[model samples]
Target: MPALGIDIGGSSIKLALIDHHAPITIAASDHYNQPSPDQLTAHLARAATRLPIPPDITAIGICLPGIMAPDGIRIERSVNLPALQGTNLPDLIAHVTTSPAPRRIFTDAHAAAFGYWSEHPLPDRLFALSLGTGVGACVLDNGQQLLVTARSSGHFGQIDVGPCDDPQPIGPDGGHNSLEAYIGLPALHARYGSALAGHLTTLTAADPPLRALVRALRIAHAIYRPQHIALLGGLGLQLAPHRDAIKAAVDEHLTCIADPAWSLHTAESSHHAAIGAARLASA
Candidate 1:
């Protein structure tokens, strides 16, 4: 039987059905952009009902970009989608699905990393960085996710290396190039809006986002010592053309280790999180 996986993020929602049998395959899939919780829930219900083999959906997995209550039913805080805060996602989902399939939930980063791990079972310790509305990461050791409870995720976006004089506010600010500001759409737009088409024509070593990304990768390599580091999400994939450039930047900055052990790869699957959800549910 296949299990259903749903991934809710800051800007998009995606769902897929995965058969965790001999050859894992996606049986069905769908996506929506920036839908409210109620609208998104109804769409999922409808999508599940219309599946070619609806009965094949024996279990369901949900991944969200926020904190969940201990009971696992309520979303205590949806960081990007504020409306989902203090709402019970599963109960809302149950209101729509006909069979009320057994369900599992995961954080977005954790789910994406898990999905990648399922597809490529190479290195035991891996780090997955999800970059879009925000940058986040998840660490997996021997296929097991760590820091997955309510507020324990590896929020790498907030990681600061500077020595501050006083407590500085963290978030989007145009003065300095924070990781999120450079990668997030709003900041990127604000910085390059005047020359949107002009800037993209020639992305070089000067791009702050690209530089910050390289720095982040070096830091990750030092800390996690992961065998592989996978990058996913809208903006993350957009940076694919500059993969070689990013590598060069890393080499220039890395002092202690000439070449890091981890191999960097861009995650290409649109159904990654959903696939991960289904895999976990089947397990």
Candidate 2:
């Protein structure tokens, strides 16, 4: 038996078959891009047909970028993908996965953190920042998600980190000079142009986005005191090569409560959320 893991993004859906025997192993995987709201079910069906999904799926884990209802069946809001608001995702997925097993829902950040923690379990408290289309963060305390607010496990991106030169704020929340306004994809593109990815190696504390990110990391240290802080997702993967520089910058204005040995890492898997969803469902 194996479980199905689906990670729905604003424009893409990533699927993975996680082996029940080996929770962390991905047996199969597929990616569908730019699916409109109406096309989601169709793409899911295509994934089911293309991937060799087992009939006896132990569970299914679905994660997305949103604030989930307490029951986890309905999405209350998704700033990056408003179309998903109030959508009954499990019902839509039921059309493709005709399983009687439980369907678990997870916030994308929580899934990424759990997935990263599953692979690296030593740190009892882990803080993970996901830098992608939008920024998100998750803190896991002894393998359980630590909810910072009533609606979200971690709303780290919405916090105002510093002022920006842009006339308008960059995130959907309309918060001025939020952390997302500094390092989010759209913000990065606006700041560095189309060749931004190519110029990541040249970024340092002098760069506005990197400087804001370091400030956010320092804030995380003061708040969570996490033993491990992981940087993951599209932008995070790109910044992996410059981990030392980023870490050094974060340490420059480090808080006294922050652990001197607190480590930073870039999650190796591109599909961390999907893998985490399936692994968590298996639990």
Candidate 3:
């Protein structure tokens, strides 16, 4: 049987058909950028119709960008794509497909963690951090139990570091301190008073503060105390420029273990949510 994975994000949706028999052969792949909820549904339906082995697909997995409770009904607070709030995504997709294949919806971070764990299956405990417009985290225990949190449990960006007040401002003067304040793309641009893209390029080449920012993330591992940590997403991968610095920082902050091996895995595709969704379906 094959599995269909779909990752829904603020800007794009990614789809893939994976053959369980031959996991290496991704039968079909597609993506749609910035489509409305209804449009996205329609596109997925069309994709389903065109899949090479539609009847063989055992399940469909969807990685959503908001809070999804265990009931699979209520969607809470999708900051990037607000339209998803309160939307029952499983029903919507089922209605669109009109197919009996099972479906599963997972938080984007959880899905990424699943994808990572599927590859590296031995860790007794693992923490996954996704860095992009914001930070998302997921934790796995004994390679089975997924610790889902209502609050920003793995939201690395929400961690407070310095005295710059809150990174995001609410109402008027109420600010909140989060890692996003210093490391987010927008904050970085604002701090430099320049375009984020240009600043990112320059930072990649040589920026002492940026290097320190990378080190700070590694230091976070000490507080969490997971057996291993995996970094995901584009921004997380970019931190590789300062990997040695980060390792040094981690060693300096950590006391429990002499030297911990923190594994870094870049997102295999921009559509990780979609890939994760498909994996969910297969599972």
lDDT of 2 at 274: 80
Over 4 Å off, model 3: 24-53, 69-71, 91-96, 146-155, 164-175, 184-195, 204-219, 256-259
Q: Tell me model 1's lDDT, rounded to 2 decimals.
A: 0.67
Q: Count the backbone clashes (under 3 Å) in each candidate.
A: 0, 0, 10
What is each predicted model's overall lDDT from 0 to 1? Answer: 0.67, 0.78, 0.58
- Which is the better candidate, 1 or 2, if ranked by TM-score? 2
- Across residues 1-283, which tens digit of lDDT does each residue of candidate 1 receive? 7777777666656667667454444432244545676776666566555544355478888887777878877788765666577888756566435556788777777778788788787556787888866677888887887674454446677665322212322444232335665555544566688785466546775666566677777787777667777787766566667777776776775756433555677777766887888788878
Q: Between prediction 1 and prediction 2, which has the larger lDDT?
A: 2
For model 3, residues 1-283, the per-residue Cα lDDT tens digits are: 7777766654445566777657532322244444666776666566555545466567887776677756767776676566677778665566335557888776677777777677667467777776654566777775453543553345555655454333332211122545555565445545666465555555541353344345545555555567766666556566655555555555654566423665544555454555666776676
TM-score ranking, best first: 2, 1, 3
Worst 10 residues of 1 by lDDT: 161-170
RMSD, each candidate, Å? 4.3, 2.7, 4.6
Per-residue lDDT tens digits for candidate 2, residues 1-283, read 6888887765556677878455444422243443456676666566566566678988988888777777767878878767677888777687557788888887788888787787778557888998886889988888888887763566899888886454646566898889999888777877789789677878877778887888899999999998989998767788888899989988986888998999999878767888888888888
Instruction: Please report the candidate that would top lDDT against the real structure.
Output: 2
Clashing pairs in 2: none
- In model 3, the Cα lDDT at residue 94 comes to 67
In TM-score terms, candidate 2 sits at 0.88
